[model samples]
Target: MDKKEELKRRQADIEAMGGPSRVERQHQMGKWSARERIQYLLDANTFEEIGAHVTHRGTRFGMDAVQAPADGVVTGFGRIEGRPVYIFAQDFTVLGGSLGEMHAAKIQRVQDLALKSGVPIIGLNDSGGARIQEGVDALNGYGEIFKRNTWASGVIPQITVIMGPSAGGAVYSPALTDVIIMVRHTAQMFITGPQVIQAVTGETVSAEDLGGADTHLKRSGVAHLAVDSDAEALDGVRRVLSFLPQNWMEEPPVVKSRDPLERIDETLARVVPDDANKPYDVAGIIGSILDEGDFFPLQKGYADNLVVGLGRIGGHPVGIVANQPRVLAGTLDINASDKLARFVRFADAFNIPIVTLVDTPGYLPGTSQEYGGIIRHGAKVLYAYAEATVPKVTLILRKAYGGAYLAMCSRSLGADLVLAWPTAEIAVMGPDGAANIIFRREIEGSDNPAETKAAKAEEYRQQFANPYVAAGHGYIDAVIEPEKTRGHLAQALMALYNKQDHRPKRHHGNIPV
Candidate 1:
């Protein structure tokens, strides 16, 4: 054959791996092929696909007769919103998108490019796990990809989009990434499928309930963002990337802020009701203080009590960890503790500053929490805060009690500046709870026990329910008015923009998992 005809024939063979039938079936299942996904995610005409002509090396079990397109994976470098990024999409239409030795090599090369170039890398995972024909080569392929995921972590941003089934050992690669975006009604991830569970444990459960978008987002907390469609998931990825820098060495990009830096929001004064029992959206305070009311909440469905996400303060990127009083009174439970710890570490790793908004009753005290290793999980948050060398600024919004107060980025945890509102009550416990123990004899001996107990509680509140006590001892740097929250935070962030902190020389700490 002539050179021109040979090139065309090879291109045709690459496109013919799954034929038209399999590609159409993938589309019918509401999933796009690997090429289509790359086209949608990256800028128009920017994707330079790599390894399109690579072939599988397996020859066992009639593998020689099998022609896998791009070895079931399409990898390339592209630009998203004018910023360079490396990406890979698994071609589920070809060999069920199973990973073989060459498929893994394609992904690892793009990942290496991303790391070397100091650019973000995204993986669009839609695989049915390892290829059976390749045996241990397939397993080794997964192991190689996972090593790259770990090596690239923190040094550069890593994101994963679960567009389809990611089962068996394949799910760990995404787990190692910084962010995960999954599509609803389609994306599913589990260590074992439902059939395996039925065969072993005999527990019957639907796939959706087992490892779907809802399951991971709301229950397992495995996915960072779970949207209705692949487009939405991709948009989520773009939004998150906008807040992060290309790498840890660089600062996060800052846009122009329409909201004035000195804007005082009086609404914050009235946002928190006097009735401590009443629930309020702490997100309101968060939105008001942030630039353009932007608060990108993470793990929103799971551990709703502790709200955490990346946001801009004075147009500068920051990680906001706030206590959501609307759920479980913003108490720190096991899941909430884990959420806070992981987020703090991520922000610190990426050179993003940390801002904590505190208003918690205390740790969630319950039999279930204790049984679920709340002590161990809660230690994770403490260790994260103490170990982080980033600029830490904490604001006490309402109640800060007991160890929970210390756990929520208090001064002892090395907060650069701990600011509190006038309404903040930094105490060992609530007034009523403390009054009961301290005045037990007085209440028990009094003829009017109820009235005496009420008076004692009232006395406790008057003395310790304000921020002045903590301010006097320097636990709180300043007790600012609610209206001045945005101004204070902006000033604080600017002053500490180039903060530096030291840590002992060590490879890495063994944090409580």
Candidate 2:
């Protein structure tokens, strides 16, 4: 046979991909094959594959009888929109997308290229963990990938998409990435499976309950974005890249916006109800103020009381952190504090401006919060705000009570400008608690004790429950109309476009983890 014809025959065998039936079954399971996913994720005709003929070196345990095309992985470079991104997609059709020495080498090559090129890298994980036939070499392959993930952190953004199982040591690579996107029913990530858990710990659990997308996104905060399908997850990755820069040294990408910055939104006035006790979605407020109603919320399922996301302000990327009164009254808790601190530090690291919307009642108070080291954890938010040199603009939307106010970028925390809505109440605490402490004796001595306490509480509210109190003392820069919030923020962000922040001499301050 001719050499060229032999090459064509092998290529056709590899493209058949364990035959069409397996690929169809994979589709029936609601996920695409490795090559199909990469094709779907990258722009049309943009992909330039690096490794397609590499096969496994394993010969033990009947591995010698199999032909593992691409060693269960497809590595290449592609464009998301017009920007370059390197990707390594594992093909589950071949040996369960198992990792051997060559497969790991292929991934490492793309990662190395991404680092040298200073472009983002995306990993589409769908594997049954390491190939057992390769033994320690398989283990070493995982170790190499982990090393690359750690070394690439904060340099080139690493994004992981879980389209299928990521079990055992395989889950750690996604954990090391800056952002993780997972599909609802098809993806799972955990150290051990339910069968192993039952054998080891006598606890029986389903796979989805143990490490599913909802489990990670809502309960554990392990994954950042969870969606209904692989297509949406891929889109999520592209959207995230659109906001972030390829590297830390450069400013985040500034997309052109046609949304009118000066347009006043009266709908914001209704999002925050006149009834202080009624809860409303903070995302509505964020939507009213951001450009084109675009708010890419981080951890939407976790620590919802504190909303963190990236959005554009007058075509410039900015990080938005706000309080959601709908959950636990928007009280600062351990998870909420950690979430905000991490987001704040990330935005600061990448040179993104911070715009904070404060409406918290205060830090959550209870034996559980204190026992959970709320004091230590809550300090993280304070430390992040005080240390950040990026342009910070804060607006007290309603209530900013106690130290939580300072924790949320108060004027004293080096905020470039601190604006407050007319409805804002920047006080040490809410009126009920303040009145009970200050007028206790007077209320107790009155013939109608309940009536007297209510009167005192009302008196306290009238005295200290408005933004004018904070503005009078220069704690707030200005009190603006609710409709003018978008305009004011655009101008404030514009004025601080070239802000320069200098820090005292130090290698790096140790933040309490």
Candidate 3:
């Protein structure tokens, strides 16, 4: 064939592969084609695909017969909300979107581009693991992607959306990501498929039962957000990027508004319960205090016991972390610790000031928790909070006990401002637990054990457990009413907005307990 004729034949082949029949087959499976998904995800007419015309090497049998654009993984850079982001969308129709040598190279090239450009990465994962035809080359391909993921950690935001089946090694990329969004019906993530488990242990379990959104969000705490459809999942990705910067070096974009800081929500005055054990929604308090309807919560489902979100206190974007006493008695556990550690690191890396609302009895204590590596995970929270160099302000709403108090950005962590509500209990432990540990002899000697215990608990509450003791020792900066929290935090963040940390000429510290 002549040069012009050969080029025309290649063009025809590409178009035929993207013809209506093939594209419609993908649509019938309730998925968009690789190109179609990218188009929908990016700004209109803005995508400039990388490696758009690259093809497989000639040695592989039937490789030339297979027609694919960008090797079934459409990768490129695009704009969302006028900020640049890198994206990759897998085409499940092409050999189950399996990773071949060229396919892996396409993804790795885009990942390297994202890292060098310092733009956020969005991975639309819908693969059936590695390609068997390529054998070990496919495995190496996944390894390279993981290496990029490790290098990009904390440097830029990495987002993964599981739009369909993602099992085995495919799940690790999403697991390493900063945020994972999964579709309810079509998306599933698991370390091993049911067939593998059945082969090993003779246990028959469906994929949905083993790794669905319901299992991850409520049970395993893996998925950050769960949506009803692919459209909603993509929209969630856009919404999440709206709050973050193009890279960690820049500040998040500000939205203009003229809301006064001192405007108090009447609900805040009554939100805290008089009794310590009663549970009230901290998110409601957060909503009442933040700019109206601006609280964008991250990881809402994974760690319902703790709340993390981004919002403007006084026209300035800030990170808000709070405890929810309504769930699991507002106790910090292994999962909650991991959740908070991730949030603190993200905020510090991006220069967003952190605002923590502390209301926890203590870290959860049980045999199961100890075995689950709670100590190791809890240490991560402590290390993250301690190592953070950004401006931190904490508010004690009700309970702050023992190591949990220190973990929640207490005085020792260099919290710029620490405020406490009148009901705040800053203690080594709760009164009941304290009495049991410290007044055992007094209670054993007393004729009425119950009354003796109650009296001792009240004495501890009055003498050592209230916020005043911490204030006296200069641990707490001030005690304020719940109504004044918004103004206080707004003023605090504004003052410290320009604060910068200049470390000594050394590498980063070991993030230890």
Candidate 4:
């Protein structure tokens, strides 16, 4: 055969994927084909395919008669929004997108290129776990991929999109990535299937209930963002990358500011109510301060008491960690601690400045928290804040009490500039709790104990619970009005833009997991 004719045949073979019928099956399941997803995600004609003609050497089960196109995975480099990125999309049509020796090699090659180039790597996982027919070779493939995932972590951003079943060992790869975007109804991730669980533990739960996108997003905190379709999941990936830099060595991409830096919102003054116990949506405060009210929330469905996400203040990308008083009274719990610590670490690693909005009463107190190791978990927040070398600017919105105050990036935890609002109640604890202990004798011996207790609590609040007390000791750098929050943050972030911080020389601090 002529060389040109052979080239045409090979090109047609690769593009065909598993076959027309299998591709149709993928569409019927409400998911895009592997190539289709790539085409949609990347810029027009920007993808440069690598390892396109690779094939598996599996010689078990049906023996060597099987033909696998692209070894069940499409790997290449492309431009997403004009920025270069490495991507690998598993073709579920080919042998169920199962991982084999060559399949893993293709993914590893892309991972290596991404790490070396200092560009982000994205994995579109729609696999049916390892190719069991290939035995240990398939298992070794997973191990190789995991090693690269670990090596590339923090150096370059790694994102995963779970579009279909990612059960058993398949879930770990996505877990290792920086963010996991899952498609609802079609995607699921679990260590064990319902059949196995029912057989061993007698728990008869469906796949959706066990590892659906909502379960992971709201309960397990495994999935960062869950979308209704594959297109939205891909869009979520792009949105997340917009907030982060191409690599950890560089600062996050700064864009033109849409909102005026000097813009002040009078509504912010009323966002925090006069009553301390009243709940408020902290998203209001976040939206008002960010550029054009644009905030890309991370793990929004999980650990909602603590809100952490990426946003721009004056067009400079920054990480915002705020307390949501609407949930658990903004108190730190195990899940919230994990969420806060991870987000802070990600921001610090990527050279993004940290903006923490504090309003927690304190740590959530209960036997569940204690038995669940809240001390170890809570220490993660303190460790993350203290260990971060980025420019840390903390704002005390309302209640900042006890250890939670310190954990929320206080002046003591190496915050570069600490700002507080007039309504901020920065104290050891709430005034009522403190007054009861400090003035116990007077209150018990008083003619009207209730009246005396109220008077002492009021006195305590006036004397020590407010921001001025913290400002007096130089713990707070500035106490500004709530209306001036955006202006204050914009200026503070600008001033600290070139902020330099150094840590003690060590291999690495032992962060509590």
Candidate 5:
């Protein structure tokens, strides 16, 4: 037990407990080890792994027979695109990548580090739920992780990638994160597996059909983006991070650009429909106005009524949340509200300034919508927008009416700059709906009730529907030409690029339900 002999014995223990073997296994899996994944995800060779020597304490069930590197969960700090970020990647090969006591402790440690450092956290998840052998200890592991997620809410960005099978309670971590990315064939996520469902309901289903990229992206909207391969999935993560700041306290990175802010396109003049009832593609207008061409749409098919996308205005990445009047008359429903809320919170998390293009009639009015909790769902959109700390610029491309207007980044909700196009119509309600309510007495009193109602509606439209009234009342910041939208938004973003809001000695605000 001399000094020299003790040092040699420690070195031998490290080699015997899967040092080179774990490294080789990473190559065989056609993927990097948990540690290697952290290295590649971060700036080259910048990761400094913490708790690399921690291992399982269990010895009775031959647990000592296995060697755990980083406790099967690689936790560390590294630079992503030259900015510091905290990351964790679970090693699925190690004991099915279950969360044990040490593994959970490692995760919480890095999460606390991320909170202290005020940096974004990226989690590469590929686990088989909790470690059953640990029983209550495993549940406590998850409880600690959940506590970190709740504490980190609105303070830093949390990203989760489901690179492999993640079942049971493991799914909630990603559910609380800002974004979730899934690989097409490799990733599978669900609260419970199909076997459990079959046992409970006597209905059979496959895992892929139950929870795959197709199911998540199209049906559940659980995953924000899906890629065909692991490489693409990783690339998607980088692309998403590029638009975001390290945290809410910092401004999003701005790149030099040659695109002119005032560059006008002929399409902008004719993009909107002259008739109020007719529908036009909002995406077309967005595509035409954003920088040259850098529009990246998220959740495109799942919630068709609302359009959420990432794009560059003068080469500065911005989150674009617009209402698609073409679908369901651009009405806010439960699903669309949920989709918009998620996108808004995501943008706010990373300090990516938001640009909302509103063209909505109002919330969808129907028995199905009411029963499905439209009021609860619609409030999410308002809460998200109101709580957002990033600079928000909203444009009224066509119709902006009622509570929908407030939910869509109106001036009252702390919108830094609100612009309206000449064709915009800002009203308490659509003229037809207003006429039905206010002019009921006049219309019902007329000999020709139908003709009187129609005339009243037209009269109301001419008097109160135009953007001029909104601008005059200071409800809108500016009434710019349609072609000038790109420049106006870029300027507004630049003006508020250094904006910061610090609460008055408060740990956090009450996030509205």
Candidate 6:
């Protein structure tokens, strides 16, 4: 064949991707092929594939006859919103999208290039774990990829989308990534398959029940986002990338938003009910302040008590952490603590300013929480907020009592500015609790103990439970109207935009994991 014809033949063979039959099977399963997914995620004609001609080197058990196009993976650089990113998609049609020596190498190359290029890296995972035919070489491939994932952490943004089965060692890579997006009904991730579990423990469970998207999102807190279909999952990735910068050294891309910075939602003034015990939806408050009410929440189903996600204030991307009073009285628990700490750290690493909304009564009190090491877990929130050098603006919406007050990015925890509404109660503890402890003897001796206790509680609230008490001590920088929260936050974030805080020179402080 002539040289030009030979090039066309090689290109056609690679594009075939495990023949037309498997491609059709993939479509029937409601999952896009590897190339198609990359195409859908990136801009039109922007993908520059890196390793398309690479083939596997497996020679055991008649492996020499196998033709694993691109070694079951496609690696390349692409543009998401005109910003550079490196990606690798496992071609499920080729060799079950198994990660052999060459497949892992292709992924590693992209990872290295992403780190070197100072851009984000995305992994479209759809594999059946390590290739058993390749044995230790396959395992070694996973080890190398995992090491790079660790090294790249906090340096560049890493996102993983589980489009198919990720079993055994394959699940670790996604777990290590900054955010994990999974497709419902089509994707599953587990350390062990159901057959193995049945053989060992005899607890029968379907794969969907064991590690489905809902299972991970709501139960295990493994997945950050879960979607209905492959297309939605890819779109979810694009949305996440919009909030992040190219790397840790850069600021998140800002869009010129039409949402006015001075715009105030009058309903916010009445958001907090007069009865402090009554619960309200914090999402309403979050929506009222963010630009166009666009808040991209992560791990929404897992930690319902504490909301953490990305949004924009005056078109500048900001990480939002809020306490949901509707759930567990917005108390911090083990899971919520982990969720808050991880999101704060991620935001800090990517130079995204943090905006915290506080309303938590305190840490959840129970034997389950204490036994689960809530002390250790809660310390993570303190450590993360203290360690972060990014611009931190905290708004005390209602309840900010006890250590939970300090944990929610208080001025003591290095927050650059702290704002509060007149309804905010910033105190060591709730008035009722403090009153009971302080007036115990007086209440016990009074004719009507309940009335005396209530009167003393009211007195305590009048003395120290209001925002002016904290504002008097200068802990709160300003006490603005609830309706003006968006304006205050937008102005504070802009003023602190060039914020520079330095940590002590050291290797790194060990965060309480």
* Candidate with the greatest lDDT versus the true structure: 6
Clashing pairs in 5: none
Q: How far is 263's C-alpha from truth in model 1 (Å)?
A: 1.9
> Per-residue lDDT of 1-513 in model 1, one digit per residue for the tens?
899999899889776657799989998998888888888889899998888998899999999999887899889898988999999999898999999999999999999999999999999999988999999999999999999999998899999999999999999999999999899989999999999999999999988889999899999999888899878888888898988889988988888888898988889999988987788999899998899888999888999999999899878999999999999999999999999999999999898999999999999999999999999999999999999988999999999999999999999989999999888999999989999999999999999999999999999999999999999999999999999899999999899999988899899889989
Backbone clash pairs in model 6 (N, Cα, C under 3 Å; residues 3+ apart or in different chains), count: 0
What TM-score, computed on C-alpha atoms, does each candidate reach? 0.98, 0.94, 0.93, 0.99, 0.89, 0.99
Better of 2 and 4 by lDDT: 4
The list of candidate 6 runs beyond 4 A from truth reads none
Pairs with backbone N, CA or C atoms under 3 Å apart (clashes), candidate 3: none
Q: Write out the backbone clash pairs for model 4.
A: none
lDDT of each: 0.92, 0.91, 0.84, 0.93, 0.83, 0.94
Residues 1-513 of candidate 5 have per-residue lDDT tens digits of 899998677656533334667557655655555655665677898887777677777565567676665567777788878888888888876776789888999899989999998898989997888887767778898988988998887788888888878898898888888888887767789988999999999889888888987789888989888877666777777887887777767767877777788787778888898988899999888887677767888877777899998988887788999999889999999999999998898888777889999999999999999998888889999888988878898999999999998889999988989999898999999998899999999999999999999999999999988999989989898988887777777788889878886445676556545
lDDT by residue for model 4 over 158-181, one digit each (tens)? 999999999998888899999999
The candidate with the higher TM-score, 1 or 3, is 1
Residue ranges of candidate 3 with Cα displaced over 4 Å: 1-19, 502-509
TM-score of 4: 0.99
Error of 1 at 409 (Å): 0.6
Comparing 4 and 6 on lDDT, the stronger one:
6
- Residue-wise lDDT of candidate 6 within 1-513, one digit each (tens)? 899999899988888897899999999999999999999999999999988999999899999999888899989998999998999999999989999999999999999999988999999999978899999999999999999999999999999999999999999988889999999999999999999999999999999999999999999999999999989999999999999988888889999999999997999999999889999999999999999999999999998999999999888999999999999999999999999999999999999999999999999999999999999999999999999999999999999998999999999999999999999999999999999999999999999999999999999999987899899999999999998889989999999999899989998899988
Stretches of candidate 5 off by over 4 Å are 1-36, 441-451, 498-508
Q: Compose the digit string of candidate 2's lDDT tens values, residues 1-513.
A: 999999899888777665688788889999999888888899999999887888888889998998887788889999998899999999888888888899999999998999889899999999989999999999999999999998888788899999999999999989888889999999999998999999999998999999999999999998889999988999999998888888877888888889989989888776778877888888888988899989999999899999999999888999999999999999999999989998898788778899999999999999999999999999999999998988999999998999998999999988899999888988998998899999999998999989999999999999999998889989999999989899999999999989998889997788888
For candidate 5, give the lDDT: 0.83
| Deviation in Å, model 4, residue 41 alpha carbon | 0.6
TM-score of 6: 0.99
